[model samples]
Target chain A: MMTQFVIRRVLYMIPTLIAVSIVTFLVIQAPPGDYLTTVVARLEAEGQYVDRGQLDALRERYGLDESVWVQYWRWITGIVLHGDFGQSLVYSAPVSDVIQERLGLTILLSVTTLAFVWAVAIPIGMYSAVRRYSVGDYAATFVGFIGLAIPNFLIALILLYVSYRYLGQSVGGLFSPEFVDARWNLGKVLDLLAHLWIPVVIIGTAGTAGMIRVVRANLLDELNRPYVVTARAKGLPERRLLIKYPSRIAASPIVSTVGWLLPSLISAEIIVSVVLSLPTTGPVMLRALESQDMYLAGSFLLVLSVLTVVGTLISDILLARLDPRIRYGRR
Target chain B: MVESPPPLLDVRDLRTHFATDTGMVTAVDGASFSVPRGKTVCVVGESGCGKSVTGRSILRIVDAPGRVVGGSILWDRDGTGDPVDLATLDPGGPDIRKIRGDEIAMVFQEPMTSLSPVHTIGSQIAESVRLHTDLDDDAVRGRVIEVLGQVGMPRPESRYDAYTFQLSGGMRQRAMIAMALVCHPRLLIADEPTTALDVTTQAQILRLMVQLQAEMDMSVLFITHDMGVVAQIADEVVVMYLGTVVETGPTEQIFTDPRHPYTRALLQAIPRFGQRRAGRALSIIPGSVPDPYRRPGGCPFHPRCAQARPGTCDVVEPATVTVAERRDVRCVLAAEEVHS
Candidate 1:
């Protein structure tokens, strides 16, 4: 039964991705002018005006002269058949090659941030709910509200100034100056780790606060449930009873949030990335859209949408595993 | 009757209070009762009477903002060992935990919500067994299945892995009973276990509980508002009003010769077959249970009692008086017998 469900879910993703790709293609096309117009305008501004013939040649070479349908067809088929996401008009390189390093770094940062969020939020949320209205709970609630209220970029700017001023240390980006262009090595990896904390903290603060509230609210609802009392009456220790019953049930919403989290790996914290000067996908995608680099921007959105679809599938499977009612389709 | 064995659980002046935002609301106030060994005692009361809280207090499973404030739950486990005051034990300490499911287990009212939806019945039942016993996995499973079968769960083997939502209302209650009984506790506190079920299912569950009580030789403290259920399963009855036990005696005696005005009013409220006339309405106790925060000065039931004397019953609290063998009533009218 589980396998069948998974198979069906996987099959459903095909049409979903197709629809998402078409929408992404059209939205990217809807804006006036193409990448060539920006290039021509830039050349003109630089006092090196291009002739119409050269501009038309450049447009033809990049397949920008084609209709929207033909262009979308080429792009989609190239991605489906050859895994080619077209060429990045801004970088003058293949879209995949341009994004490969940034994509890896983004995923690494997102995964670490997610881990930090869960590791800190879950225990604190459970504690807050279990000992509600206590001193510790009040403190957590106060801090959580602050975290949720402040913008991530403002937090990023403040942390950067603090570390650079009082600590006399620069803490921005995912690497120090020495390892900025260095090859993959133990030293570079160690340096990356040393510089990773700031970005992780800034990106994770809001999520952790939101997650804590979710877990606390969900757990509070479950704590007073009769099942919890039954478990307590069964002599289960306070901690075990909490983790084994209410906490497990309370985690369902958190599990379902994975669908949103996966896409955030590619597009979250855009302004923060720009402020910190981190070589992550968020900033690159931002520049691509601003420059009307349709191929690069469209590819980025398509990948994000696909991740969303796949992430939803993963969360559904996990939810089924966690709740037997969902797995058995029983009320 | 051949001399009954000593009471398995003795509760004395149990006072459980909840520290709500409004104030400290005393849910169970100075209530006293005892459950005789190997017999069923039903605590009858309307809503807000604190019958459920009284049972929860005995098990020390009252939710947050509520706790047993003052009480001595003397649990005589084997009828030979010195009774232990359960109320004094730290609710979360090891001593009380050791006693919670090993010697005393509880089944709650909502069978649907009282069992965790995420866990299978066998696993939930096995959890208690594992906590209290040294049984191996197979033995724990064996014991769980045995109890499930004893509780009349259909096809216990196949039903073991079923979730509570998958089971019918009757089956869910059976699963709950199985969970409570898996450890072979000396006492079982069932707080309105059948109140959520249909009438047919209620009868089946009550019958199953009675059968298991006999087979396991365990005392049961059943809490309910249903007088018919009380008459059917109770060997002894303790009627409570506004967190206080107003009358208590053997079931037959309480039914035949109720001494307290509240008890008599409660009995009169039950709708009997063929007793309803064309226009005459069924009798109901006048007034509702008083708010916990503003309990009346003298008798809590004075405003609701039919025979209350304004000067006497409203000014002075009535003391419990023994009017007959093994029967007690707290009422100004019953106090006259002691004076005589």
Candidate 2:
């Protein structure tokens, strides 16, 4: 039954992704002119005569001279058959290669942030809910509120300044200047880990705070449920009782929020990466959109939309696994 | 010759209170009762009369803002070992923990919400069994299946993997009873276990419980507001009014020779076929239970008590009087009325 449901859902993703690609292409083309216009304007601003022949050849080479529908069809077909995402107007490389260069770092940052948020927030939230008005609970709530209120970019900026001022070391980028372009190695990995904390902390603060509130509120509601009382009456140990019933139910809502997490995290990363100077897709996508790098920008948007849909699907499956009411069918 | 064992549970001077933001609300005030081995004691009261609180005090599962302020719940383990005071045991201590589901289990009122929806029936039942015994997985599953079959559940083997949501209300209640009885607890505290079921299902559940009690020889603390249920199942009945046990006696005696005014009103309150006056409305107790925070100074029920006297009943709380062996009433006029 579960396998069939998964297959059905996976099949549904094809049309959803196709529709997303169409809408993304249209929206990316919605703004006036193409990448060549910006290049021509820059050259003209530099007092050079407009290179009409060069512009026409460049446009044809990049398929910018084709209609929007034709361009979309070519781009999508390339993605389907040849695993290409068209050419990047800005980077002069394939869009797929540009994204591939940074996808690893983006996933690493997101996964680490996810791990930090869940590890710290869930426990604190559970404690806050159980203890309620205790000093520890109050302190945690106070810290959570502060975390939620501060913007991620401001947080990134402050951390960068603090590290530079107090520690006398650069906190920018994912590696030191010496290893910035170096090949993969143990030292480079260690350096990457060392620099990963600042961005991770800044991006993770808001999520941790939000998740803490989610778990806290949901747990507090579940604690009063009759099943919890029943579990206690059965003399199940406190911790086991929590894990078996209330916490599991309370985690469902948090799991559903996973669909939105990646999108929000990516959006937040754009601003934070610009401020912190990390070489992730966030700043690249931001610059690509601003410069009308349609293929580059469109590919990034497609990746994001795919992540959103896949995240939602994953959350749905997890929720069904965690809660039988949603899994089997509505009673 | 062995002396007859003491009662299975001896609760004396029980007072459970909730320290609310407004004030301290005394829920169960000076409730004293005992549950004999192999018998059912039904605590009959309205919604706020604190019968449920009394049940929770026995298990030490009262949530925050509520506590057993004064009580001695002497649980006679095996009816031979020294009685352990449940109220005095630490709420989460191992001693009480062992006694809670091992010696005394509880089946709550709402079967729908009582068993967790996420867990399978076998797992939930096995939890109680596993906590009380050193049973391995196979042993626990076997015990769960046995108890499920004993509770008359259909297809016990297949039902083992079924979640609570899949079970109907009646089946869920049966599953709850099965979970409570998996360990063969010495005392089962069923707080209105059948109130949420249909009439026919309620009869079936009550019958199942009685059969299981006889087989296991365990005492039962049945809490309910329905006197009809009390009459059907209770070997002894404890009638509570405004958090106080106004009268307690054998089920027949409480029904036939109720002494306290509250008890009389409660018996009269039950609508009997062919007994009502044709033109008159059904009899209802004039007033509701008073707010717990602002309990009347004297007899808490005096404001609504028909037998209340002007200065005496309104100004002074009544003292409990022993009318006969194992029979008691909390009323100022009991002695005068009994003598007359």
Task: Go through the candidates in order and give each one's DockQ.
Answer: 0.88, 0.81
Cα-based lDDT at residue B268, candidate 2? 85
TM-score to native of every candidate shown:
0.95, 0.96
Best by TM-score: 2
Error of 2 at A138 (Å): 0.5
The Cα RMSD of model 1 versus the native structure comes to 2.3
- What does candidate 2's lDDT look like per residue over B1-340, in tens digits? 5766799999999988899889998988899988988999999988899989899999999888889889799988776758889889888777888887888999999998888889898888888888888989998899899999999999999999999888899999999999888888999999999889999999999999988899998999999999999998899999888778888899999999989888888888888776555655678899898877889988888998898999988898888888987899999889666667
Instruction: Please give the lDDT score at residue B137 for candidate 1.
Output: 91
Each model's TM-score for chain A is: 0.91, 0.92
> lDDT per residue, candidate 1, B47-150, as tens digits?
99999899989878888889898979999887775888999999999999999888899888898888999999899999999999998999988888899888
Task: Estimate, for each residue in A12-61, the C-alpha lDDT of model 1 and write its tens digit.
Answer: 88889889999998987788887677677777888985799977876675
Backbone clashes (count) for model 2: 0
